[model samples]
Target chain A: MDLKDKLVSSFMAFEDGIDVNDPVHDIRSEAIKNFETKGFPSKKEEAWKYTSLNNLQKIDFSVFPKQESALEYKDIKKYFLHEIDTYKIVFVDGIYSSYLSETTHDGVDVCLMSSALTKPMYRQIIELYFNKIAKKEDSLTSLNTAFSKEGAYIYIPKNKAPRKPIQILHLATGNEASLMLQPRNLIIAEENAEVQVIERHQSLTSNEVFTNSVTEIFAAKDARVDYYKLQNDNANASLIDNTYIDQKDNSVVRVHTFSFGGKLTRNNLNYYQNGERIDSTLKGITILDGKQHVDHYTLVHHAQPNCESHQDYKGIYDGSSTGVFNGKILVDKIAQKTDAFQQNNNVLISDKATLNTKPQLEIFADDVKCSHGCTIGQLDEDALFYLQSRGIPKKEAGALLMYAFANNVLESVRIPELKARVNKLIANKLGVRLGFEL
Target chain B: MLKINDLHAGIEGKKILKGINLEVKPGEVHAIMGPNGSGKSTLASVIAGKEEFEIKKGNIELDGEDIEEMAPEERSHNGIFLSFQYPVEIPGVSVTNFIKTAINESRKAQGLEDMPANEMLKKIREKAELLEIDRKFLSRSLNEGFSGGEKKRNEIFQMAMLEPKLAILDETDSGLDIDALRIVANGVNKLRGSDNAIIVITHYQRLLDYIVPDFVHVLHDGKIVKSGGKELALELEEKGYDWVKQETVA
Candidate 1:
């Protein structure tokens, strides 16, 4: 058999060993069938033109293995965790680790996707909403759905707002040469409920790994959810992350993604303002050096009248790295009075660096206010000279100005813990300490 | 404290400061008056070591050190300052943070340790009050949404914070109202000492009335055509730039 057929056979064999009667198992089977029909996308695909997943098809990724080493919190705390007070939920190799998780809030329910799937209510919700928002044409979405085993499920009841944020830590550790981890998260904020969720993925081993994660967020009427995803995998790691968000009437959803470390990273964010008076804001910052390649694709769909969406994605490419931003805003005919704005700005710090930015808007409504713009340039010479004239050395001044450029998006994060974590990530990516006084 | 000998500079291959000569000893305040495109700002920028301006021929001396080829930061470390006519608006960087960075950088360049936080905050508050600037302005982004007068005052506040030996005010009074001009001039005068010098570059004599210059030079067609006492500003203000142009032609 060819490689494609052999891969499909392997996946089918793996699925037969696990229980298939559960709802999640049933969904997995359907997803695998979907993936078998649509294998890895190539450069010919419109969306996948700038970002090629051809490298992923060449590797034979192994399923997650049983735990072989003891998980330590000290390294996690020293590198990824901070002092911010929050409800911490830790997952090792995609499985929920109870000993590493803690929560003090009473109004919220945080549980493993496995446990939540057992409950009829959560299972019904997941069955109805899971894998429903991301487009079916996306091969990565199908791949994530087919390989989903361990995940986190957070549910905030109606009229409840948690005081502290919910921190989700995904730690990848194993002796395998190439480990493939699929972390799935479903967050449902009921009507008028508010919550802050922070999802951080880090690698505990130096082995080459690939993390495929899919997160779905649902904000009900009048509910507000602030979500932050920090991807700081090991230098040798690669990740494909897909996040889908849906908003109801008068709901607000904000997603901030920070890409700091990875050899090859691709993030797809799909936001749907499906109800009137709903609003969504998507912001991302990608700092890449070395041969790292980062691609961000965002789609903001205004499906209802009077809905609003804004997208701002910026990148700082250094060394021989490459960054890509493809953002699209779609305003349907019925979505009149829609207000959407999208902007992608990039800075090339090295001569060998490259950036590809495309901002697209498709508005069918006559009364809509839609605008999109993209800028790719180097650092502002005047600002640099201003800083240098104040006695700051050239390098420190450049670093400070770059940090200030990133602070525009970083300051918008409402959750303090996630903000601090993102700041550290940015510092590390720039090869500078967090508190470089000079 | 500062001297410029036959300075010739330009931007993008076009000459601006042609054979300009000037000298300012400690405790002296000199004014450079010029018409449009006469390169008043160019001279200040060149003195501050801005790289955009190419100096074809000239020598700039600060405290007996040749600074013609030095970078802007090196010039700043040697006690040179320029109060930019149009200060940049840096979003997401607070005024306090910018000033602290400037102070720390200047100190470190001078072989001094970074100042303690308490002491730095106290000094900033004192300077802010002296310039009639609200303490809250320190927390705002650096000149992000500042008004014309506020930007000028912020420049003076930075001048006070840095305490350079030679402070070049390049059209610092252009966008300021009379009251703001008075406050900025007062800040400059208060910071002036026997060990420092000031260069006021302006077109009108309004700012000169508040902070009187000891000497005034008329710059026309990229060259200084006339030099006189502070009264020369009033004469130029009365007759306009045409008089200076006519004199240069004669």
Candidate 2:
């Protein structure tokens, strides 16, 4: 049978240990039916024109890991931002690893979705925001919803802030030869609350693993949220990430994605300004080589007046790798005095590499300000020669030029440690130690 | 210290520097003045080993060694420097860091390790002081938002740090004010030594009053039609290029 058919037939067996009569189970059943009907998106779809999931869907991916696996901290220490203390929610082979996790309930909720979904005390929050903001028609999100029983669930109360940042790490061990994972995350910040989160997905072995993950964020009045996604998976891994954010009045939310290593990655990031004077910022840096592929599809909806959204994405493609970026902005008739700006810049270091960038703006308000700029080209020859003329070799000159090209996006990264880590990664990706201490 | 023999060069199949011959010895300053499109910049670029220009015939030699086959950085390591007219702006790299990298790279080519940190810092401080540049300016991005004067001063600052054997100033006086030009010429004078050579390429005689060339050559239609003492620059300023064009054609 096909992967979708197998998943549908195995749905009942997946619920052997859970309460089948719970209200969340009905939602799961409905989501599975939606997946069965929609199957996988094809290239004919406008949003999927530059990316294709045909090859991924043909492989017979097992819906669940065969068994639970254990990992040592030393083996995967390089994957985490261990330079600073953080509340960690780690999973191994789709099972929560208590040995590797550090949960807390001191002033907020930093726990598992399973506990929040099943326990009686957290039912009110689960009912109000389980899947409220996620688009219902997205089949991949539905696929994640069908199996969203085990992921990170973070809740910050009003007027409170976490002592440190939170890390959500999912490790895929090739115990089942070929595995598929669906990890769901929900983060809600009450009025005047503030939080920072870092998420990453890693595959430990040379086995095929495809993950469909969904995340929903809600920032209430005067709240602040900073989310970072670190994607540097192994060669055999592929990922599709769907993130939806809802912002209220006087709130600020920023999401930064750094994509360096992966066979294929697709990011669907959506932001909705539901209240006046809201601020939304989206930024990303992608450096790919060796036949890797990454696509970023972003959307910003200005529904209220006097809102603002800013987006900037930079990419460097080498070898035969391909990249895509499509930014869409929508301004309603009432969203006057809105300010939205988007910029996408890319460099193809090799002749065989390809990149496609498009900016779509649908503005209804006459008085709003919406501007976008996109550029795809190689490193400036004049700039390269300038550096070389100063005694730097050609290769190092090109590397320095590229590093300078992608430097501005790093300015908005609030966490200093994370910024330093990304700087090192950029240097390493260019295959240079540089003169400074990278 | 530098020799160009019947050199023919061009870019994209269009010949610019046609049948040019010149020589300069150590401690001597040579000035090449020409009208627009007279191939002065092309000649400088070809001497510095810019690959975009094609040398159709002849060759360039430095200190009795043929250098037409070497790359630009190799030529730089051999102590050849060409200060550009319009400097490229690199947004993230600081001026101090850029010069440090350039100095270390040249040293590494000579089978030496990277310069010690303290020594590098001291050298940078001295150079900045010599150019009268502020400490904060050293940390800013290279030439990103610099004024015309600031950019010229930065080029001179880099030249001071590199200390090349053969320095080619390509239009160093193109967009400088009088005060800025005097400061730049003053800095260049301090760096001139009997062990190195300088080639000043300009269109006007304003800069020569400050730096004072040993020999002046007027280029018309890709060839130096006349060579004379420092009075030649004053003659060109007074009589204009029309006089030189009529003399060359006659």
Candidate 3:
């Protein structure tokens, strides 16, 4: 059978086994319908021209099996439990592990979306905004919606700002062959409320796995949200993550994506300013080596007047690896006085390594300022010689200079704990020990 | 303590230093006066082991050992220092850190242990004060955003810190105000000793008035044309380089 027929057959088999009479099941069925109409995008599509997913469609992977083995709290504590005081939520194999999660804030509400679907108020909000901002035309988003069985739901009440950040850890563990995991998350910060959200994705086993996840963030008027995504999967894993952000009038949003591991991964981040005087900042750093392929696609849209957006992404590719970056800025006709800037830079260590960067700006309004540029080259030789002349070995000198180059992006990360963890991961990928001494 | 025998060097297949010879003994200061493109800086760089120039035929010795085949860092470890005409600016690296690393590396090459941090800091402050360099300059990035005079002074400050056996100041007096020239000359004079030698390469006699050389050499067209006492410098200052070039051609 063809690929579409096989996918249809697999969906039919999944529907007959799982319960489908609830509201969540109804949403899943509608998402499947959307997937059937959209299908998977090909190279002919403008957005998917540089990044081709034909290899993903050719794999025959099974849906993640139910994890029945009881996991001890202490065994998984190392992944989520840190010294910082914050609200924590843990998901094992794409399903919420209630026994391993905790939250203590009074004005905040955190619960599993599957259980939260039973409440009318929660259902009303999800129906209003969930999956509304993200494009269903893309197969990845459609696939994530079709397999959105177990995910997290976070809500901050209007005008009430929580004191601590909310942490979500997506832990994937399965002994089966080629497990496919999909994690869906929805976060909404009401008007005038402030929140910090941290998302981490990790794998327990070294087997071949595929993780397709989607996260949607909505910041209401006068609200502020700091969102961080940390992806450190096993070397034998692949992932496709999509993040959609929407900000209203006078709201501020900052998103930091740190990608250090994965055999093949793609992250699509889009931010939309739908109200006046909104500000958004998107920063990311990807460290890869040894045949790894990491692609980052970002889009910033200014639909209202007097909005500002800034985007910067930097990467270090070494050892016969490859990286692709495509960033776009779109200013609509009504987006007068819009200010947008984008830059992408890469450092290639090996002669055989490659980087394909395309920075674009589309401005329809006459009274707007937009600019984009990209740079791809090796490290500065003068800088290297200066460091080596100071007794640092050639390798250590190269690594130290690379660290300083990548630190420019890391310095924008506001959370101390998350920043430190990301730095450790970057050091590991670059094969350089951190200079931290007690 | 340093010797150059028939040194000849060039860049890009063009010969610049052609069959030049000089000897710098301990407790002596030598001034090399030459016209423009007369290979004064070439001699200094060839001795310091800069790799860009090709040594067509020459042998450079540091303390009776052949140093033409040594690396720049190796030569530095062997106590041969060159104050470049245009010192490079290394951003984001502090002066103290750069000097300390150089000192530790040299010491290690001599099979000695690293110096204590407190002792090193104390010595740096003392030497900096002697050179009239502000203490805050040590914390700034090495030579970055420094004025020409400041850059020249920093070079002397580094020479003081490294304490090399043979110091070659290549055009160190150029681009310096009168006051800065006095300060740099004072610093160099204080660092002189009976066990070390100094080579001052310049084109003018204004600097010779401050740091008098024991022997003066007139270099023209890739070779030292004349050798005499310190009075030769004053005569050259009176006649100018055009007279020397005409006399050499004659």
Candidate 4:
């Protein structure tokens, strides 16, 4: 069977393990119906014009794995931000991994979504927040919701901050010939609370692995949240990440995505400013080579006055890699004094590489500042020649120039260790050892 | 130390340097004087192995070896340097790091190990001091947000750090004030020796007064119209390049 039909058929057995009378079950059933009504997105859709899921849908991905897999910490340690200590909520093959995880329950809840869904004390919070901000009409998100049994669940209470950052890790071991996973994560930061999170999806082997993941973040009044998504998987792996964030009054939230590897990856990040003076920042740096492809579709809905949003994304495409960036900003009629800025810049290093970038804006408020800029160009030959003239080889010169092109967006990374790790990855991807630290 | 035998080169289809011939020996300084569009910079770039210009005819030899097919880095490795008239700005790369990489790459090409960190730092300090460059300035991105004078000085600093065998200063004095010009010329004078050669390509003879050349050649229409001693530069500055143009035409 095809992937979609297989998923539709597996929903029946999927519900047998969970409580059938729970309210979330009804939501899950409704989501499956939605996914069944609208299958995978096609090239004909306006948003999916540059990125097609037709080929992915043709692959007969196994919706459920037969057994849980175990992995050693020393083997997959590089995939994590191991330089720093943090609370880790890890999963392997759609099942939670206790041996490889270090969860917390001191002042905040840094644990599993299965616990949050099944436990009695956390049902109220689950009922209020789960799938509330995630788009129900979007077929991919609904599909993830239909199979959202396991993932990270983090919550920080009022006027408190976690002792350290949180890490939500998903590992896909080569337990099956080809595997598919859907992990849903929910994070809530209450009033005046703050937290930082780093999320990554890694495949251990070269086997085919497809992950459809969704995350919903709620930042309450005066709350601060920083979320990071690191997508660097093997060539046989693919990921569709759907993340939604809701910001209340005076809350600050920023999401940084670093996409360096994968055969095919799509990031759909949305932000809704529900209160005044909220701040939302989204930044991404993507470097792809070989036959890799990455698409970033983002939205910022400014519904209240005195709010601000900033979006900056930079990409470097080499070999035959393709990239896309479609950013949309909407300002409601009453959102006066709203400041929203969007900028997407891309550099294509080869003639075979391609990029399609577009900015969409719908403004109804008269008193607001909204600006967007898009640029696509090759590496500056003059700059390369400059470095080459100084005795550096042409290849290393090109890598250095590309590094400078993508270095500005990295300055805003608050985590020093993560930034260093990313720098090393970029250098490795460009196949050069920079003479100096970034 | 350097020889150009009836060299002809150009960019695209248009010829820029036509039948240019010159020779420079060790311990000698040759100044190529010309007006704008007279192909002085083209000769410098050609000698430094800029691929934009095609060498249509003849050859450029360094220490008796033909280098027409060599890449820019290869030419740099063979002890040739060109101080650009308009230096490119590369942000996020500090000056110290850029020079360190350049030096290490050149050393690696020559099959030598990386210079010891202390020795490298000491050399950088000595060269930067020769150019009167601030220590803090060496930490900034290479020429980013720098003034025109600073860019020119940075080029001279690179030349000093590399200590090339044949250094070609292409209009290095164009953007500098008298103070900066004096400092830059002083730096070049300090680096000069009997084993190296200097070719100063400039429009104004004012720079020649600071670093006096042994021979001066008037270039017009892509060819060297006249060759003489250091007095020729002062004469051209007095009579202007129109004198050379008219004399060539006559």
Candidate 5:
């Protein structure tokens, strides 16, 4: 059977393991109906024009993993921010790994979604904040909402800051030939509270793995959130990440995505500015080669006045790799004085490589400043000659120029350790060792 | 130390340097004076192995080894440096990092380990002092937002750092004031000795006053039309480039 039909039929069996009397089951049941009517997105859709999920649906993926899989700290330590202390919420094969997690309830709640969903003490918070910002109409998001069981659930109460950043890690073992995962995340920062989060989904086996994940973030008045999505999975893995963020008055939120490896990856990041003087920043750096494909689809909705949003994305494609960027900015009639800017720059490393970039702006207000600039070309030949004339080889010279092109967004990273790790990843991806740090 | 024998080159089937021949030994500086578009910069670029120029005939030799087939970096490894007329701006790469990478890559090509940090820093400090450059300028991105004089000064600073055997200054004095010119010339003078050579290519004779050359040649329409001693530069300056152009036609 096709994947959608299989998922639709598996709902009964999926609900059998859980309490069917729970009120949340009603929401899940509603979501499955929505997804059943609208299956996987096709290339005909304007948003999915460049990215197609047809081949992914061809593989018969196991909707539900069998059980828990074990992993030692020594085996997967390289994936975490191990250099510094962090609150870790780790999952293996869609099951929470308490042994590998470093959760805490001291001053804030940095624990499991399952605990927040099944337990009584955390019921009120879940009912209030869960899936409030995630789009209910997007087929993939609705599909994730249908199977949403366990992911990271973070709650920073009013006037409190987390002692350390949080890391939400999901690892998929090759226990099954083909597996599919839907992990839902909810993050809420109350008034004057702050938090930093780093999320990554990794696949350990050479088998095919697909992840359809959704995350909803709420930044209250004067609150701050720094979210990082690092996608460096294996060659057999494919991920579709859908993240939504809502900002309140004077709140600031920033999301940085670094896509280095994967067979096919797509990011649908949306931001809604609900109050005045709010700020939203989205930045990405994608470097791919070897037939890999990465697409970035972003939207910023300005509903209030005096708000600002900035988007800067850079990509480098090589060896027949493909890249797509579709950025949209929508300013409502009342969103006067909105300062929205978007810049997307791409480089094709080979004649076979391809890139498609489209920038959209639908402004209903006259006084707002909304502009976007996009370019897709190869690296500058003159710049390459300049480096080569300085005793750097041709290959290394090209790498240095590309590195400089993509390094502009690294300065916005607030965490020094994460910045350093990403810096190394960029250098490794470019296959050149610089004389020193940029 | 450097020789070019009957070198005829051009770009895109258009001849730029035709049958050019010149030689310079160690401890000597040769000044090539020309009008605009007289192939002075083209000659420097051809010797530095710029692929845009097609060598229709002849070869360039450094220490008696013909380097016609070497890449630009290989030519640089063999001690050939060309200070660009218009230095490119590379954002996000600091000047210190750019020079360090260049030096280390050359060393690595020769199978030598990277220079120690302290030793490299000491060399950088010494060079900065010789050029009278501010310490903060070295930390900024390479040539980004630099004034014309600052760009020229940076080109000279890179020359001081690399210490090439054959340094060709191509219009390095175009955008400099007298004070900057004196500083750049002084740095070049300090870098010269009995073991290296210099080729100064300029349109105006003003820079030749600070960095005097042992020989001077006037080029016209891709060929050297006049060759003389240091007095040749003063003669051309007083009479203008038309003197050589008219003489070539006669």
Candidate 6:
């Protein structure tokens, strides 16, 4: 059977051991039906023009792993921001690895979605916020919802802040021949609360692992939320990340995505300004080579007045790699005095690399300020020569220029250790060691 | 010492520096004064091994070694420095880091280890003080948002740090105020020694009054039409380039 058909037929068996009568089960059934109807998005669609899923769908991806695998903390410790302490919610091949995870309930909920979905004590929150903000019509989102069994579930209480940042890591071992994972995460920062989260999906061996993940974030009044996504999986891994954020009055939410290594990665980031004076910031840095592909599709809906949204994404493509950035801004008729700015800059370091960038702005209100700038070109020859004239070799000079080009998006990274890790990754990706520490 | 023997160069088949010949010995400062578009900058770039200018005839020799085939950085390793008229603004690299990288790369080419951090810091502090640069300015991005005078001063500061054998100051005094001119000239004068040479390429003679040159050459239409003593700069400043252009044409 085809992969979609196999997933559709396996849903019932997937629900056999779990509670079949739960309300989430009905939602899962509805989601599976939606996925079965629409199947997968194709390039004919405007949004999927630059990205294709035909090759991914043809592969016979096993919907589930028969047995869970174990991993040593030392083997994968480099993947985490181990420079500092964090609440970790880790999973191994769709199974929660309690040994590798450090969860907490200290006046907040930093636990698993499986626990929240099955336990009755959390039924109220699960009913109110689960899968509510995510778009129902997105086929890939539906696919994730149909199999959203285990992921991170974080809920910060009102007027409380997490003692440290939280890390949601999904590790896929090559236990199965070819594995497909759909992990769903729900993050809610209550009024007057603050939280930071880092998410990653990693593959252990040189085995094909495709992950379709979904995360929904809600920032209530006066809440602050900072989310960082590190997508540097192995060469055989691919990820499709769909994140939806809903921010309330006086709330601030920032999402920074660093895409350095992966076979293919797609990020569908959406932000909705639900209240006045809300601030939404979306920034990303993508440095890819060796036929790697990354597409960033971002949307910000300014639904209220006096809200602001800033989007800046920089990419450097080398070898035969490809990149796409489609940023959309929607200012409603009532969202006057809204300030929205989007900038996408890309550099093709090799002649064979390709990039497609588009900025779509649909502004209904006349008084709103919506501006976007997109540029695609090679590195500046003059800048390269300038550095070379200063005695830095041409290769190192080009790498330094690229590092500076991509470092602007990292300016607002609040965590110093995370920023340092990204700096090192950028240097490694560019294949040069900077003379000075970044 | 630097030698240019009938060096013919141009960009895109358009001749700029045509049959330019000059010689400079150690401890000598040669000021090349010219009119606008008279190929003074081209000569400086050619000597620094800028590849954009195609040299069709002759060669440039630095201290008896043919450097015409060398790359710009290789020439830099050989102690050739061209202070750009308009230095490129790098947004993220700090002034300290840029100079450190330059110095270390040059040292690496000589098979030397990286300068010790404390020694590097000490040299940077010393050079920065010689240029009257503030500690905060050293940490800012190189030349980004710098005023014209500040950019010239920063270039001089880099020249001091590198301590090249041949320093080509191309229009280094164009953007400077009187105070900045004095500071930059003071820095250059301090760095001058019998083991090195300086080539001052400028249209005006105001800077020559500060860092007095040993010889002055007037270039017109890609050729050195006049060669004389330090009094030539003051004479050119008084009579202007029209007198030289007429002299060359006649």
Q: Score the docking of each candidate (DockQ).
A: 0.60, 0.76, 0.21, 0.66, 0.81, 0.71
| Per-candidate TM-score against the hidden true structure | 0.96, 0.97, 0.82, 0.96, 0.97, 0.98
**Model 2, CA-based lDDT:** 0.91
lDDT of 5: 0.92
State the DockQ, from 0 to 1, for candidate 6: 0.71
Query: Mind giving the per-residue lDDT tens digits that candidate 1 earns over A1-438?
Result: 443455567677767656677767767777778878887777898888888766765666666556744577776785444677677778877667777788543777776776666667666787777777866666667767876666878888899977778888877775667777778888889999999888887777777677778988999999999988787777878888888998999999998888887888988888988899998999988888888898998888889999888788888999999988989888899999998888788889999999988887888889999888888889888888888888887877787777878778876798665666677667666775312332
What would the per-residue lDDT of candidate 6 be over residues B1-250, giving only the tens digit for each residue?
7889998999999999889899999999999999999999888888877778899998888889999989888988889998999999887789999899889988988999999999999999999999999999999989989999999999999999999998999999998999999999999999999999999999999999999999999999999999999999999988989998998778
Best by TM-score: 6
| Runs of candidate 4 exceeding 4 Å displacement | A436-438
Model 2 alpha-carbon miss at residue A66, Å: 4.4
Comparing 1 with 3 on DockQ, the higher-scoring candidate is: 1
Against the unseen true structure, what C-alpha lDDT does each candidate score?
A: 0.83, 0.91, 0.80, 0.92, 0.92, 0.92
**Highest DockQ scorer:** 5
Docking quality tier of candidate 6?
A: medium
> Could you give the fnat of all candidates in order?
0.66, 0.72, 0.07, 0.61, 0.80, 0.57
Q: Candidate 6 on A1-438: residue-level lDDT in tens?
A: 788889899988898878879999888888999999999899999999999988888889888867768799999999899999999999999889999999999999999999999999999999999999999999999989988888999999999998999999999988887899999999999999999999989999878999999999999999999999999989989999999999999999999999998899999999999999999999999999998999999999999999999999999999999999999999999999999999999999999999999999999998988889999989887777678777888888899899888887888999999999999999999998778777
Q: Each candidate: RMSD to true structure?
A: 2.1, 1.6, 4.4, 1.9, 1.5, 1.2
- Pairwise DockQ winner, candidates 3 and 4: 4
Clashing pairs in 6: none
- Expressed as tens digits, the lDDT of each residue in B120-187 for candidate 1 is 98999999999999978888999998999999999999999999999999899999888999999999
List residue ranges in candidate 2 displaced over 4 A. Answer: none
Query: What's the C-alpha lDDT at position A224 in model 3?
Result: 91
| Docking class of predicted structure 2 | medium
